[model samples]
Target: MINVGLNHFLIVSGILFSLGLYAVVTRKNAVMVLMGIELILNAANINFIAFSKFGNLGLTGQVTALFVIVLAAAEAAIALAIVLNIYKTFNNVNVDEIDHLKD
Candidate 1:
């Protein structure tokens, strides 16, 4: 039998955050950057839920996590819309290639 603890959650969150950061920094595609950002947000939610559970913080963590989910959704929608518009305007979705919004 194995027991999971706060440390395990923290480690998972840390890995997620690191991966997200890497993606955001290294990825040239706009969509991939957004995905990385989502990963970072998820890592945060995991931390919040884990702390809430271990610290007996009741619904606070869960509520915060819910808010984060909503925020992430909204962010993704708006960002994807922007990316689409950028794609339409520039015909390219690479963040590095699109240097200027106006010509």
Candidate 2:
């Protein structure tokens, strides 16, 4: 039987982080960048919970993860709103093209 441990969680989290980074770096669409940011936040949450469980950190990790979830939701809402505005003004949601604040 393979015992899943902290190392396993860490490895998975690392992979998620890398994927998030790749998406953020390579994607041109604002929505895709937001998704990548979400992925990064999720990866961090995974690490927090995993460390909390393995390091005997009580409820701190779980509580922090909850807070992070709430923050991520709020962030997504605000970002999407801004992206919508950008799309309305520019007719596109590409991150690179929306370079200036002025029309």
Candidate 3:
């Protein structure tokens, strides 16, 4: 039988964070960037829960993770709305192309 430890969870979270960073840096589309941000937020949540479980923090970590999830949801909602408005105004959602304030 194999036992999972904090190190294992940390490793997974690290990988997720890295992938999220890559997506955010390399993707030109605003939606992809938002997805990457979500991945990064999820990675942070994983770390919070893992550390809370391994440490002596009781349910604090879990509560923090829940708060993070709520914040991420709200952030996504607002960001998507802004992106939709941007698209409607510019007819494009490419981050690189939407550089000018004046259209």
1 or 3, greater by lDDT: 3
How far is 6's C-alpha from truth in model 2 (Å)? 0.4
The digit string of per-residue lDDT tens for model 2 on 18-99 reads 9999999999999999999999999999999999999999989999999999999999999999999999999999988888
Report the Cα lDDT for residue 29, model 3.
Answer: 97
Listed in order, each prediction's TM-score against the native is 0.95, 0.96, 0.96
lDDT of 3 by residue, 62-100 (tens): 999999999999999999999999998999999988888
Residue 55 CA displacement from its true place in model 3, Å: 0.4
Model 1 lDDT, residue 43, Cα: 97
Model 1 Cα lDDT, one tens digit per residue, 1-103: 1598999999999999999999999999999999999999999999999999999989899999999999999999999999999999999899988988675
Model 1 stretches with alpha carbons more than 4 Å out:
none
Instruction: Give the Cα-based TM-score of candidate 1 against the true structure.
Output: 0.95
Best by TM-score: 2
Error of 3 at 87 (Å): 0.6
Error of 1 at 12 (Å): 0.4
Location of the lowest summed lDDT over 10 successive residues in candidate 1: 1-10
- Model 1 RMSD vs true structure: 1.5
Q: What ranges in model 2 sit over 4 Å off?
A: none
What C-alpha lDDT do the candidate models reach, one value each?
A: 0.95, 0.96, 0.96
Residue 10 in candidate 2 has what lDDT?
91
